[model samples]
Target chain A: MKSVLCILFTFGLWLLLTWSLDPKVVGVGLMMAILVATLLAHIYPDNPHKALDPRRWFWACIYFPYFLVLCIKSNLDVAYRVLHPDLPIRPGIVKIRTRLTSEMAKTFLANSITLTPGTMTVDIVGQDLYIHWINVHGVDAEEHTRRIVRPFEGLLRRVFE
Target chain B: MSETIAQWIIGVGLMFDLLGCLGLVRLPDVYNRLQAGTKCVTLGTCMIMFGTFLYGVAALDRPQMAVQALLCAVFVLLTSPVAAHAIARGAYRAGARLWEGSVIDRLGEDLHGVRPPAERAEPADQPAAVHHFTESES
Candidate 1:
């Protein structure tokens, strides 16, 4: 099942990248995708059936636009800080816990945090993520988790977990 | 009309790129610099690619160019954060210090085994740690 999913994914990527529908091109793409999937499918550890869930796809679609808006807002915030004279930064590394158990979900969470407002993930030790915040408003782990992780965690849980 | 819109978007993107470079110069330390540089540049470059896609589709009438440009934008979005995270991790592991005005250093504390007692107590439901042994130890 995983192999089939991998093959389909790889072939879909090939089609998108090539943007061609010619039979010869498609045949070659299918062959390559099969070969790659056979070699790489083992690395995909999650239940392959999860990838077929329509609800996850719906959330993922929602996530992209939501993330874009957040990205733009954060960029403007960063721009303000960059252009300001006093700099106004109170940077710090704080540890926050994540409810995400899977490695893939944790990775997505980390990447999202890095790209989001005023935070960059410095390290992930067990369930705790060490984040560098440009503006340190709080000290405690629960406070940091509430402010930093809460926003994305629900959405990510629906999509990945 | 589309050409003008694309030009404006590309212009704004260029301005963002400039600010990100300024950030690289102005920020205090490695972590701060990475934050500014990575976030700003990633968005800036992705916006530029988006502009290119619009230009290709409407101005040049080339769907292929538009698709490729959009793909580039997506690629940048997916990869930039990962790259930034790796750099941050590497810098920390390499002993790069945070800025003087920094308020905390949880990662450093964790690495040095100086975490507060409250944090040291693990929940009973938490999974057991995995240990790996080298040839000699084994």
Candidate 2:
């Protein structure tokens, strides 16, 4: 099942990249997709069936626009700091705990954190993620988690978990 | 009209790219630089790609070029953060010092068994070998 999913994904990518409907191009793409998918199927998530859920896809589609707004806001914030004469920054690495158990969800969470606001994920130690904040606001870990991780956690959980 | 819109979008993207480069120069440390460079540049490049897509489709009437541009934009969006995360992790493990203005060092504290220290105190710069605990435990 995982192999089948992988083949479909790879072949879709190949078609998109090639942007062709020619029979020869498709035939070669399928063969290559199968070969690659067979070699890489083991790395697929434990529950590949979750990918088929329409609800997950819906949330993912929603995530894009939401994420874009946040990304723009963050870019503006960074721009402000960069252009300021004082370079107003109080950088720090703070730890925040995540309730996400699945590796894929955790990865999405980490990537989202990196792109949003003034925070970047430096390292993930199990449930504890060390984030480098451009402006360290508060000392408490729970508060950091609330401010940094909570916004995306519920949405991501619905999408990946 | 479409060409004008695409040009404006691309122009905005160029401004963002310039700011990101400025950040690379102005930021005080490796981590902060990574933050600025990655976020601004990734968004900037994606916007440029998006403008190209619009111009190709609407202005030039080239579906192929538009599709390719859209694909490039998506590819950048997906991959840039992953690359930034890897670089940040590697820099930390390699013992890159945080800027003196940094207020906390939780990773250092976790590894060295110490609390957050005084503002100017530097963490002992041990080799990466000493920080194998993350890999071993996981």
Candidate 3:
């Protein structure tokens, strides 16, 4: 019963985010969503632990605005560095110690870091997140990676595990 | 001011993408280089798409171009990290060693006992401590 609801919800969200908003689009989207949901249910559907958590959803709702602001800000920073005569770039890969225990949190952190500019999570070894930082600013690139990935971890923990 | 700001944003995004490409070529390790390629290119391309979107809105007045730009942005958002993960996992599976300066390898000693290729062929006589997966999975 809950699985059906989850599938419907997931499909609905997918439909909403797609290109069209018309009734035909919505109807097609709904059918596609159901197919996807049903396929997902068959694949690995029985984890009650993956259920909805209000706190996580609340954080997710707010996180987007924060991400947008950072996206714009990072764009400006990268542009400035690009145009500047100095050509500021300290290229290096750094390993960050991840404290999150849950797999979902770690995955969230990994994806979120990639979402933001200037850093990418290239490798994850257990709780250690190996990141490639484009411009190694200030003293601690490792610390910077940790600081950026930290928020996503918290919200992911609340939601998934 | 707004026009200048928009120009600055587009220019910077392009710069970062350029830097990212340079780093991907210049960096020492696969992991390090992948980072440059993934984040920098993804953001840089995104900026270009966004600039196009802005131009579409302010200049051409075409909704289709803006929509296409947005679709590109969404596509980048979804695939960049996934590609990174695939690269990292492929590297690991192919036995690429982690950096020495790394502070910790939480995977170190925690595998269901999967050993490196070199260590795997040691000896059947060696006890459970360095347990071999081949012998056990059978």
Q: Specify the highest-lDDT model's number.
A: 2
The value of fnat for model 3 is: 0.21
Q: Which segments of candidate 3 are over 4 A away from where they belong?
A: A1-58, A68-105, A115-151, A155-161, B1-8, B98-138
B1-138 per-residue lDDT for model 1 (tens digits): 999999999999988888888888888888888899988998999989999999999999999889889988988988999999989999878666666667777887878668553443333433354222122321
lDDT of 1 by residue, A19-137 (tens): 99999999999999999998989887677677799999999999889888888888898899999987888888999999998877898999899988999998888999999999998
- DockQ-superior candidate, 1 or 2: 2
DockQ of 2: 0.72
Q: Model 2 off-target regions past 4 Å?
A: A21-28, B115-138
The 10-residue segment of model 2 chain A with minimum total lDDT is A42-51
Q: Residue A56's C-alpha lDDT in candidate 3?
A: 60
Candidate 1, residue A51: the lDDT equals 74
Question: Candidate 2 lDDT, tens digit per residue, B10-110?
Answer: 99999999999999988888889999998999999999999999999999999989998999998898899999999999988777777766788888889
Over the stretch B27-67, how does candidate 3's per-residue lDDT look in tens digits?
Answer: 44565556556667777888878887776676778777777
DockQ of candidates 1 onward, in order? 0.56, 0.72, 0.15
